[model samples]
Target: MENTTTLGCLVLLCIFITFPRTKGACRFRRFGIDCRYSCNCPGGCNDVNGVCRGPCYPGWHSGNGTVCQTKNIAYNGSTKQSSNYYTFKYLSNKAVDGNRDQNIYDGSCSHTGLNKTSASWQVNIEPPTQIYQVKMYYRQDLRKRFRRFTLYLNDVDEEWRVCYHHQKDSIQSIVNVNCNITTKTKALFVYNERGTPETSGQSYERHAYMELCEVEVYVCSKGTYGDCRQFCYCKDGPCDFITGQCPGSGLCENGFTGQHCQTDCSSIGKYGVNCSESCSASHCFNRQMCHRVTGRCLDGCQDGWIEPTCVKHTQVVPCHLSVKVNSDATELCIRSL
Candidate 1:
């Protein structure tokens, strides 16, 4: 009987090996659905995990469900350079107003207030951003005046880090600058100090006019603007850098709460980038500001308080019965400790 039982077990093992489960393991689709294997790649990516896949759809991710995320391109139709326009002969903001018109006959040549010996045009990328691609279009008609321009990233120490420099070269052409500038910066500068070959520091030469039809600053890689919020949680697809909007889970980063994750989590007991940190109700001993991100007491709780945003209490007093006399009048009273 024992021999028969062993033989039965062997037969069962053979059967299991002959008909192994093949979900995600089948290699040949020619064998039909019963033999087709699959991976966790997005609906279209057939590459193995961790391989550098082709660029996903614009504003989308490979692992994500292909939902278009917001790109972090520098020009959002709102981000402009400094309010200090290059005051040339009549040039002003129109030159850098993001309008690309080659029609010098219609004032495109002088729209940005031309011919300044010392002038600067800068763009604010909000909290400073690592810019990689910078495209500056010289006023089509006044291209000759855009000679000798330099690009810089403003550092926190108030120093300018020169990224690109253009010599007194051809005018009336689009200058596309691509570089690896991966530093978080507050602003980018277009410092054009060179005037026409004859213009001086004190005087403006009509040939030395400096103007740009359009200044477009963009991030290098595709499918991203500056950076995504915590990788957009990488759920459904990705997040938009400019808008702070995500796809999957429809959730924003910490310290932020809203449909689009645009509103910060600010009230009485909270503060931080994500806004999810909780501050102490009584301020952790009643005399200190909690940490903005961790919500810990900056000055520590008083004597009898817990940590990590807990309440504070002096101490619990015991109750006692006692007799007291007021104004020579003896009376029995209950005193609280």
Candidate 2:
């Protein structure tokens, strides 16, 4: 009877281990067996395995895509601001050092000069990786210092797209924004437009300042969309990060045709934009063969045909008759070809 009871207990334990009781679902940023582990991952974490829902936060890496470890992508990047406040102690690189200390005196935040019409901060991510999201931690004591600020993505010197904008006067100490850009860029800007409006006409209210505590820029190590598991195969630039489709209003690259710009124009003896210009139709000399880029005839034009493009007929001189007046005698001379 004791042996029988032991066998029944083993069966009961197996069932209990196989089916643990469900206690609702774990909230965002929390994961574990009992939902106890917590980390400030921007894309959240999986409830079952504690892996990051997206890529690990900037300045962080996941060896197994589950544990967030020390690897500073943002800290390695360079930073600069419009102006430094007071002294050089409050440098722009402090914001990206992976420190969240709100105290500027603690050497973890960035500050700009006072009474400025506009203020800006920019970070240069070397090698130009895909920017999934940006999170800014502002100084809580002086939240008013940051108003009407905007986030922009830059390629070299040009601002290609706007990541986010703050329209309200009142904001929290921390702000998170998703960029969702198709192509990768090298720079990012946190800018305040020129001439801030004054609420009470105070001198401080007429200007803007950049007082950032910490800045986090998230990027996937590999894929772009949907938990960073899928990849894009576009010929030029990149496809939409989320949709995995070609960007730029359905426009394809030169010498390529189709929605994804995958088909080669040379396969059909065609060239130019969208492969609309055909080499055969252009009268190429080498059996309608042409260069894919310039659409020029490879072996020159056929007999009596133009050299380039081979589309026009060669001009031919017609027979002519010339009439001349002699100065010595009052006689007319006619010369025939």
Candidate 3:
């Protein structure tokens, strides 16, 4: 009886170890999944019920589920420079009155009336380094005269030491100014200074109406300190100075077409490099692929022949022999020879 009781107790212990009671089983209330052990949450820890938790890092924002995206800030008002930058215009005169020319340089001596006033705009910028460049487009009217204008960096107090002044009749000048800022600056100010009073009794008022057509500020990377050539390379794309790839779509200017866009059709097949020579029927009798670089055919064909390839030929063919007509006053005689 004692041996049977011990055997029964052993059997009960084995059953309990193999198949435990289902009560108190840890159930993942959020995912609707049950586990024998404590639920080790996957991915991010569940902060609240039915939702995962994560944070967007710097320069990026959390967009919906588990996705981070870079924030796109407007550079220019309406003009789009690229996916990264924008180009916008800041006019001196917003009233649309003809008193102010849109292209005139602001804060210049020659700008008359209310057009002489100067304005500044702010932009959010990101640079790879502390040194950057600012580009401005300016033009003066033929009658206007200007001495110098001051460009302020970041604030009206911190101004560029160099004064940009142009003589009369200097129209449409593009100026690139380099700036180094120790502190973060988001605003730029432009000041106009008139040199002397005009003969009309009105002060020149610096007739310098300035227009900010486009401004590009890029941070310089290492090994490119004070080197304009290095500045040319630190563009949006990889530098290809030999091909001038930084400005355009990796293509050369003019009517050229190629990878580097260096080949000009007008400059090919000419006396030297210009396309001047005209191919004649004797040189290129049949339809042939004329050498673009040279006005000559690779192969020549017979007079009545079409092409060396002969993929297709003209249906009309001229006979080799012709009929001879005999000279007669009344009767006419003709024979094929």
Candidate 4:
């Protein structure tokens, strides 16, 4: 009787394992098995095949049955901004160092105010995808009495400040800041606080100058998913969502051509068919018809002729030849006259 009971339990276990569960089935509790497919899980986290293990997190999504990935977003801008402070201005001046003309500013300050000189050139960032971080590059000029600076994102009101203090003859300093870029427009504001009255009246004798070079923005889809954004040329192919058309490369497939790969090559002359074969050959020797294939004279002249159509002779013979006669003959010798 005990063996019989054991066999029955085994059969029951097999049936539970092999059979498919109905809707709202809690196999995790029924069979004591970590459920691979369960609609009962929170957020409809399809745990089918045990591979689809995790729920689609807040910033993530799953398309295929088992593959969960982040989405891709694109950002559009003429210039990429950097977080490094030295990339602001003074982008390698030629009058400074012999081998390298660029100079670094070295001064000290407390906290003055923001400088808004570059307000005309508005930066429009349209992300074809989502973005996460933004980096900027900047440097201070020593002659200007380098000091502290502030960065403003999107607008002047949103700002972050950093300080620098250490008097030196001349030096260059760089700073990098990571910030979020959720909007289309971003602004940069630099504050020159070299010698403020509140801190030290010593009066920093230099005019603080800042240089910005480049800015880079990092993007992520659905939290940390998708491809890192890149400036694509879209050459010889369809225009990417960011840039309009492909650049520098040949036209896309089919009949496309030209710089933007927009010209159609369908009408271009091809071999055989109705296309003119010898139409481009220059008409030499006047009206002589040129062989379509060889682009040479068809039935015109063999050689030696020089007329426009090889119809006239270039060489002719005179009617008579010149002969020498004796002038001092004896007595009017006209015997045969």
Candidate 5:
């Protein structure tokens, strides 16, 4: 019994020692009535990339370089992918490292050198970013590579949707290819492969390769960029970078979202940024304290409202050929004379 007790104590001690050093997620009131996640940690917090999250201290605070720095998702790896072959697979992902400069002496790590023209490079960005453009700095030493290329962005369906394609006529030097896309994507792809129009028109075109010295991907600002259904902002108020919400109702102190919460939460069934959430009220009609979504019904249909759409159901022309439509169908009404 003593031996068992000792072993149990040791196990407990090991667990305590090995646990990740993170405080439990906490929430507390802001200005006495508002609640918010505690960003004012003693040390620091991990961000979306699982690294130390940073920015400020508390109440218009100060910091090193962590503040004013948002996300640079191009270099971060968070996608699930497998490639048959990527040019210069020896040391991949050197292009998106935010370093576009080249070294003449040591040209090895400066770029990718794929032998097969069919090679490709891909990366996933997680949390679907709103991309606008991609800038590529091809290898200057080679000077002739990546003239013809294609860039793709992933859709909500996770497909490698082609957004832009480039075809160059001459062998330009020190030229940066800028492709404008402006779409939401979780995956990004770059290639100089088959099916993308061979420039030389030679059979050797099949053996073409690519050397990307650097690549810069730009995303649309969530507050004012693409997929922002509609946002609300008073005077020139900015929005939250992470949530795309503006701060505060033009009057309420809870803070706004989407274009500074300028996005209307007035939808009958949805609310929040881009109206992404369902209402919390069970029956909007019965008014049993609805969800954070202003108009959504948490419970079943209340009074005359229906599921999903929390608005009062008024009789209207049926859209489908169902029993309701048949009952209301008249020869003249069907013919629309």
Candidate 6:
């Protein structure tokens, strides 16, 4: 009998080893029942599902990692600059009015005073966002005026960080600069100072000017990536706005778990970090009444269970009867300690 049992176990092990489950031949960024869906996220997708396996690309919402929407956050911000060419025209807000007419006189581009030693244009973004990219549209006819410029980002701390610096004298009409680091910032700046070339010996004879036609700031929502549709519960601060990469562990809310915090703890009668605590111990009236975050019973504990946490059994203590006589009243009470 022992020999037969050992042989049966060996045969089952051999069969399991011979036919291991496979994820199939889906290529990177491809998923779905038949591996026919293409993911918008660069990180690809799980072999069995079309959801994004990683962060979605900027401007693409991570709704299953396949929705695309380009949102320009700068359009709603207030704009300002050091100086303007004319009081009635070339206002700073012109650069963010959702226009790219390129013609400065048409009230579309923002122009700083010529011969100024320093010039700057800035926008205060409403509802500070996690920004990743900035797009600048310069005057098409005078592209050289936008050369040797620096892009800056200011966070809630009011500290300015350099996003990009143009070192060349020749620039294109439209330039896109990647901040490289995603940040929860509130302001964007275009600054230029005369006589200081980004690279030594570069052109510095011309005074600085901020003649910008339009500025578009691209951002992913806080704690989200791609079209800013997914939620990422990072243990530390916010995750990378464009990549969905957390600075710390992939932590979830008390009632949630999984790499993206998508799985609810109640699914497994568990709660708390990683769903390691069992809800069954809560002694709730109904198993679903246990609070996932606090482990407290919502509808009250069952008979013989304690209040609040309901985890402990009620301790029955002996009660002593006490009698008191007053001038006009008699009282009897039972107390337990």
What 10-residue stretch in candidate 2 is worst by lDDT?
Answer: 325-334
TM-score of each: 0.39, 0.48, 0.28, 0.25, 0.41, 0.51
Every model: Cα RMSD to truth: 21.9, 26.5, 29.4, 32.7, 20.7, 17.9
Please, what are the lDDT tens digits per residue for candidate 3 over residues 74-149? Answer: 1332221111111222333221121223343443211223334332333433331232455444443432332244
Better of 1 and 2 by TM-score: 2
lDDT of 4 at 107: 18
Cα lDDT for residue 181, candidate 5: 42
Among the numbered candidates, top lDDT falls to: 6
Predicted candidate 2 versus true structure: per-residue lDDT over 116-195, tens digit per residue: 88899988878776677677899878876676788988765566688788887578888888876756778888997446
Tens digits of per-residue lDDT, candidate 5, 52-164, equal 24443322122233221223456545322223234334244655555566542344223334345465666677677666545566666665555566777777775677766
With candidate 2 superimposed using the best TM-score fit, by how many Å does residue 40's alpha carbon deviate from the native?
Answer: 16
How many angstroms is residue 189 displaced in model 2 relative to the true structure, after the best TM-score fit?
0.8
lDDT of 1 by residue, 67-169 (tens): 2222334443333332333444335444445456756555543333334456566656665665666677766655655666788887665767888887645
Task: Score residue 152 of candidate 3 by CA lDDT.
Answer: 51
Report the C-alpha displacement of residue 169, candidate 4, in angstroms.
Answer: 15
Which scores greater on lDDT, model 1 or model 6? Answer: 6
Better structure of 5 and 6 per lDDT: 6
Local accuracy by lDDT, each model: 0.49, 0.68, 0.35, 0.33, 0.46, 0.70
Candidate 5, lDDT over the whole model: 0.46
Error at 75, model 4, angstroms: 10
**What global local distance difference test value does model 2 have?**
0.68
Predicted structure 1: lDDT: 0.49
Question: Candidate 5: which stretches are off by over 4 Å?
Answer: 1-71, 78-90, 104-115, 171-183, 194-199, 202-206, 220-337
